[model samples]
Target: MERIAIIGCGGSGKSTIAKQLGLTLDLPVTHLDAVYYDENWKPLPQEEFAAQQEKLVAGERWLIEGNYASTLPIRLAAADTVIFLDLPAATCLWGILQRRWRYRGGQHHKDGVFDRITWNFVRYIIGYRKQMRPKVTALTAQHAPHARLLTFTSRRQANAFLSEVTTSA
Candidate 1:
């Protein structure tokens, strides 16, 4: 509950759940998108990004959200809890569309970056379950053996867990 890693596909509501959990648990929140991308949508170097993540995880408490699977092992090793949002691809596609419309011509509310919804992004979301999920699952099992792992197959389940956590808190 203290150190949490919220990993999922682009439109899988990782930022949303991280924010809610951060509020409920009184922990600081870090969006990996914000950490990796600048306001102009420029990316930080991979080494720099990993270095930044290293510093964040060294803290005693935080809720870090993103699906940068390459560096997942770092956070997984440090987190006390890991939440994997395994929502359907269609739902994730719809989420991206909704997010584009909601934040039209402006910075995204969650990450404060103006991201484009390109066809490649859509394809990535669609292929995530088949491509990325297995790797993420394996990484979690291998790297975060002692961490409490929670996988939600749908948004309803994720919200329900949030509600239960909030109420208990």
Candidate 2:
């Protein structure tokens, strides 16, 4: 599908899925982290961030990944597909650890992704399903009711979905 939106808690593999979907669909991928944060980890101004997303979503084909709930409607309104990585908190925490080790606790400038970890982030991940899922679900319904929604509760399901996509592509 074109104009895809990927959302999830930190370390839930939004970026990973976005990359795979981009490759399979031959769509350009935009990591919202790249758009929202700078090399120094400074965030872009809120208005500018929203504007950037507006422009990105206006494109004919794109795969944007992030969970900026406040700005979610922009992408949601435009996406033809939305993929939610609804993995358990434990899995997500483990993902953070693995990514941290892989990056050696630093930033990847090319991807504009930071691999830093903190207690707050852990807490957020732990609380995401309870706290954020409803909001995300509501937003998708409100803004992209026509879009195909795909929610994977486990990595296996996600992998199988990817395999199917790859085969079709």
Candidate 3:
């Protein structure tokens, strides 16, 4: 599929799946974390973030992974497919924990990108659920009906979906 949008809760492996799909399809993958998080985990301005989203989705073929609710209409309008990683809350929590360990365990991301906050896990997992998941689910359902929406309930389902789907761009 061209112009795929992988939207999901934090630590749902949206970036990971998008990157893998991009590699397999020889397409470009854009991680929202890389785009939004600047040095020291500071957030970019709303205007800048919106601009970035616009420029990214302008591509004819690209895979973007994020749960930016404000950019949903823009992103989904241009996307031919939307892969929703509807992982269990437990799965996401576990993923976040594992990631924290990796980030705090001495793995540095691209220059000043991944700060690896040792304590934000609770917020991203528990707090973001009430704050973000509702918005994401609503937006996906709204813009993804015409678009191919692959909602994976678990990691196994995700892998299975990828196994059968040809990622040729």
Best by TM-score: 2
- Considering only N, C-alpha and C atoms within 3 Å, which residue pairs clash in candidate 3? none
Candidate 1, residues 102-161, lDDT tens digits: the string is 777455646533457888888899999999999999999999999999999899999999
Q: Give the candidate order by descending lDDT.
A: 2, 1, 3
What C-alpha lDDT does candidate 1 achieve relative to the native structure?
Answer: 0.89
Off by over 4 Å in 2: none
Tens digit of per-residue lDDT, candidate 3, span 31-149: 77778776467788988998998998888899888777887777887888988787767888787667666566332434212435456655666666677768877876786667887
Question: What lDDT does the true structure give each of the candidates?
Answer: 0.89, 0.90, 0.74
Worst 10 residues of 2 by lDDT: 105-114
Better of 1 and 2 by lDDT: 2
Candidate 2: tens digits of C-alpha lDDT, residues 1-169: 8789999989888878888888888999999888887878899999999999999998999999999999999999999999989999999998899888778886775653678798998999999999999999999999999899999999899999999999988
Better of 1 and 3 by TM-score: 1
**Alpha carbon lDDT at 146, candidate 3:** 76
Q: State TM-scores per candidate.
A: 0.95, 0.97, 0.83
Return the TM-score for candidate 2, rounded to 2 decimals: 0.97
The order by descending TM-score is: 2, 1, 3
